[model samples]
Target: MNEELSARLRTAAEAHQPDRARILARLERGMSGAPDRHRESSGARPWPRVALASLAAAGILAGGGFAVAAIVQSPPARPDNSGTPAAPSAPSAPWTPPHTTPPAPTTGGPSAPDRSSSTSPSPEVSGGTVSARPDSAHVQDGPLWSAGSLDASSNTYWAQSDITLKTTQPLTALTVELRITQTGAVQSTGHWRTLPADDFTVTVQPEGAAVVYRWTLKPGRTVPAGQHVFAGQYNHAAGRREAKHDGYRVDATGPRGALSVWGGFTPAR
Candidate 1:
């Protein structure tokens, strides 16, 4: 019975409320030929909200794709704050091995001249004479006093006299003096000296008014022998092949008919 009474109460409430038709009628009146308050208040349709949400989602996706593309694809290089781009470095060159040859002996004898390398002495001035003098000489101990023995005393002796002459032909009357000295001997006397070649191998020339004479010392030999004074025509000169005890080499090519070389041995100071 109580259940029945509650049902009746609900029925009564329904009866007092308007029917669906009446509700429809009220809505039509509010909407008929007039602006809708709901539409006016919102200012736009509700569907636009959905469209805006979709557009926003698309924009976000595009921006994310662009960011990913910048990382994967070529990215613009950033410049340094100094406004200059960095340059790539050059690669290093490969190392080469050092050449291997033993260094030449440092303390060996005089190097042999390279014959293959054509090397000539400086062109000697024509008609000029060059000579050499000894810097020092020593008298050997003991006396086997021969003219040659004087040469032994002269071991410390050397002759050097350089003369140059510029003449159309060889100079005539070229006089060379070889100063001989003896020590460790009981007595000092004059003796004869010799030259290597007596065929006027020693040439003379006029280097202006001054006559220049030159003689080269042969290897393993010291003094040149023969005539003391060499005199002859510029083209054809004569020398002494054999010297006399008086120390004079015969020369027939002079105004005196015979020119003599003058020299002697003296006590060394």
Candidate 2:
């Protein structure tokens, strides 16, 4: 029985030894494979990271190049059929103002008749009575008188004519007409000379009973009846005087008859 038991125990021990050897070999192989797998995994992870970094760099470079190209290039211009550049538009014409004509001057009213050309009509005389006649006839039968004198000493004088007429009837209207001329003589030579119309002035004042009516002379042109109207100077070195060289006449008209008187003077020698 002891021999039999020993045989069984030997068989069991042999089987158990073979199984333990196989398990230990398998564990050693598994341990060595685990380090190789770890190295492979770590290497593979670095490859993926390098590829991502290269892609990102390439993308950045490409984006930067595209941005530079966009910045450097200019916008395209429209094509023109004509080769010559379009002429700059002409500057607008300067504005011009229109010209206007001036109006003519206006005259106040109708012009007066020119009396400087011809002499007035002469007077008519009968007995001691005298009357003013039209230009057609003349009558000579009355006494004439002279007033004042013109000499070298009399350089200026205000010569006046006053007359009292004798008539059969009372006189309603009377006019005294005096004709005067301006004369001057040089102080050194004493040569007498007559002044121009502008150089001297004449005015009338009615005595007795008569108011001045409208004047026969031009309106607004004649001097006032009592004021001094200066005639232009004939000679700068000459003395001037109011001379009645042409003489004066007084006419008194009434219902009975018209009476007139005349007077004048030449330079006294």
Candidate 3:
């Protein structure tokens, strides 16, 4: 009996064929709590129902477990990123500072251009000799100088002052003024200079307590280097009029700067 049962089991297993429609029908009836109509129609025994259920379960596992899961379950949740070891991040590149251009080199100061070799030259006196006047009252200042002499030809009724100026350099501008202290009815007679008459503007006027005679070189005109003379003639009351208090002022301009000289006059005894 055991051998025969084993043989029968072998034959049943061999004859078993997986039918999706039949298995699903059975599954549907079981889910709906309805009797298995096919089993009742065939008058199959209860064990046959058990066998069908078991075979159905086996068919599901063997044939269509993945297919059933694909139909029944929702799409798998997005893969969990937390547990997975993150792909090794590509090695970070070395940091490098931005390239910078340095500021241009600078100099301490701008090189000054070379000016004239010298500002003031050794005092140059062109025709350079100075006149000898033993009897004259003379005063000198650097390159610009002046001298005064009382004219011997003056009579008791008149007196004269002769002024001489010497300059080493050609004078671009010159002004000579003589002030004779008024004594005994002093009055102007005339005035003269060695420079061209047109080169000077002469004026005789009374200033303060003295008679002033001025010679101004005209604009655009120049006095050549050497000695130049200017004279003032005036009449005074009968007696000898002392000229010790007489004075002179000279203002001259040269290439670099101005020259000025002024002093009182001493007539010969």
TM-score of each: 0.23, 0.23, 0.48
| Top-TM-score structure, candidate number | 3
Better of 1 and 3 by TM-score: 3
lDDT of 1 by residue, 28-132 (tens): 435444554534454454465445555654654455445444444656676678968677769899999999998888967898878785332321232342211
Q: Comparing 1 and 3 by lDDT, which wins?
A: 3
Report the CA-based lDDT of candidate 3 relative to the real structure: 0.71
Residue 36 alpha-carbon offset, candidate 2, angstroms: 99
- Residue-level lDDT of model 2, residues 42-159, one tens digit each, is 4244455445555655664455445444434547566588786875778999999888787876787877778684443555453443322222222221321223234434434222
Choose the strongest candidate by lDDT.
3
lDDT for each of the candidates?
0.32, 0.37, 0.71
Please give, for residues 32-111, the per-residue lDDT of candidate 3 as tens digits: 47676544555444676666777876766454544443434547565576897555669999999999999877877786
Where is model 2 more than 4 Å wrong at Cα?
1-170, 184-237, 240-244, 266-269
What lDDT does model 1 reach? 0.32
RMSD from true fold, candidate 2: 29.9
